[model samples]
Target: MALNGCSIWGCAKALQPATSTLSLNSKHDLGKCGKWRRCCSSVVNGVESSFQYADRVQVQITELDDGFHKDLNMLPKPLTANKFSSSRDGTKLCVAYKGLAGAYTEEAALKAYPKCETVPCDDFETSLQAVESGLVDKAVLPIESSEGGSIHHNYDLLLDHKLHIVGEVQLLINHCLLGLTGATKENLKFVLSHPQALVQCEMMLTDLAVTNIGVDDTAAAAKAVSLDGRRNIGAIASSRAAKLYGLHILAEGIQDDDNITRCLILARDPILPETNGSYKTSIVFSLQEGPGVLMKALEVFGLRNINLSKIESRPVKRYPVRLRDDSKYESIKYFDNLFYIDFEASMTNPNAQHALESLQEYTTFIRVLGCYPVDKTDISC
Candidate 1:
């Protein structure tokens, strides 16, 4: 169990070949009630022939039981590779994004690592699963969009999964209105895109009388409009998506706000950035029920001069329940909760550690999500 790199063939090689080749033996049938039967087939190669020999060896063991009622014992289970290192080293990072192959998420990942391979998933949660199950080295998920606001599912997923947030990327979101060849705004009657895209372009679309259809993703909307070959339908998506799908650009910068941007989190094993600068540390914790529990929790950060960037409360689903005193209800519910807080200090800072230590007495659960370099690039002119 040393922490050396995982061997790809260790599990396969350790299992007894006879156990893998077990077959039903027909000769020992107890008048059609026997569970064992024979397997007869020609071996294509020496490896398969060796497997057959292993099967014969296993069949002989079952035939040795002479008594009608005999006790049986199962063999020990096989050992598997350590779950953490399966997707490390040269393994490709499987990334899931909400758009097509050439979308912003993919672009950011490529920007981070030029040669890294990418896997396009349908949504954000699927990307998390890919990383959680060791199928991907890391997941790049969008947590906030500058113009549209925060992506809440990703924040919730961070609390649900043990995967760490190691890095982050800020990508400028450039919105484009695309349509098929010969399509024009005057002829268009409907626009299709994701809900966020629709919201971003709300004012731009208001001037026109086109009906808005919310699809699953931006690039998918573009592809649909392109494939449908409709001259009256347009899609709100990225300029790259328009070019990839062979769609014509009807207009550019379609978002109501020009400062649209998205904050993406790089997660696998969370680590503080190497470079020094103003840092932000995200932590999640839950407090025991008390009169001043929340106030005391906030005091820890305030006392240490640690500025909180963001704070939100969410109910903890796993705690025990109790009866309510309210006259409106008869049933009781659990009061467990989780508080997500982002502070303007790195985990490396003494004040940050001291704040957590002070709050630990009242906190039932606590976890540090990540400490990353602040995105100080101003979008405003």
Candidate 2:
């Protein structure tokens, strides 16, 4: 009479079975069982009598109280891919960049994945959106240029979007001052290029009293000069751009620093490469209000021996309420809120996980942007 392992419809005693009969296959049937009805029936006839009734009703019940726990334990854990094997043939890879065919970003993407179909965007933000909307598999955007400092807008965009910086490419930026076939430095009165390009050649531009014009892109400026047949105008761009636009280079290596390089970040879905060297993980978080909060946040990385490559702070736009007793709320500036960071560590390492666990106690928001192999090559032209 003892149905120790028996369960009506394999449900736990804490759970209620269906009021209607549970049909198994076309013919077999498990009679109606309800929590209240079963309980009252059990109390009246005793537990053994209820088991006998269940047997008569032909209802199979699992006796295990931890049925849900056992079922969950039986399920296989999720598996993850850990290698950089090339995607299958006919598998399309979308790469977004802001430039013409021979732009440096495009060149870098081609160098990284020669078979990828490149999508040309008009601006960097557009490139970021292309990847966000799933139009592209990845986007290559410049983060810092050796000669022009950091691209601040892109850094802001990195924080604004939920995209990850999966990998990086360091490309040598060789600036060529290009003009019409017969145009020379002496005849030039105006120079056209992207702001960064113009900054890189500031010294060269100073030597020649040329009016610098800011354009959307260096290659686009070269195309404009070539199309307009500007005999007195020149463009500071790459040699490849001059060739593409049918312009002649009046002078090459015009950038102040001949070894100028730009760091390009490749953004895509979270990619965990199987075999990588010297990995770096980037994370962004904001700390809760308290004294020693910043120090505590930093100690997590320090204790784990994770090198902080770069830490930057941007005001959280949504939260603008400042705590100031004075009437002049605008005058008193306080950088109370900040985006704490950690860098240059592999996620697979236990120390990195422990560091994040430590960080969770103090931080209000935390996100791992990506874990990628470090590109440590001096790509100088």
lDDT by residue (1-381, candidate 2, tens digit) is 112211111101211111212111111011232311211111122222221231122212232232212222132211112211233353688687877645777777775678988766767777777666666778887776656666666765665565676777777778899887778998898887878778888998999988888766787677657655558888888777776666788999887875444444556456664433687776656565567998898888898788897776766443333443333432333453446354877776667767776776676445566667787766644
**Local accuracy of candidate 1 as per-residue lDDT tens digits, 1-381:** 111211100001110112112221223121232111111100112211221231123211222222311111121111122322343465555554444555667776665566776656656666666666766667777777667566666776775565665556667777788887778987888888877788888887888877888776776676566556668889888877776566778999877776445555555565534435877777776565457988998999999999997887765443334443444645544544568888888766767767776776566445667777776665453
Count clashes in each candidate, considering only residues at least 3 apart in sequence or on different chains.
4, 7
Runs of candidate 1 with Cα error greater than 4 angstroms are 1-94, 111-115, 146-148, 258-262, 272-275, 318-335, 378-381
Q: Cα RMSD for candidate 2?
A: 26.3
Best by lDDT: 2
TM-score of each: 0.69, 0.69
Using alpha carbons, what is the TM-score of model 1? Answer: 0.69
For model 1, which pairs clash?
Answer: 24-37, 25-36, 25-37, 26-37
The list of candidate 2 runs beyond 4 A from truth reads 1-91, 258-268, 322-336, 340-342
| TM-score of model number 2 | 0.69
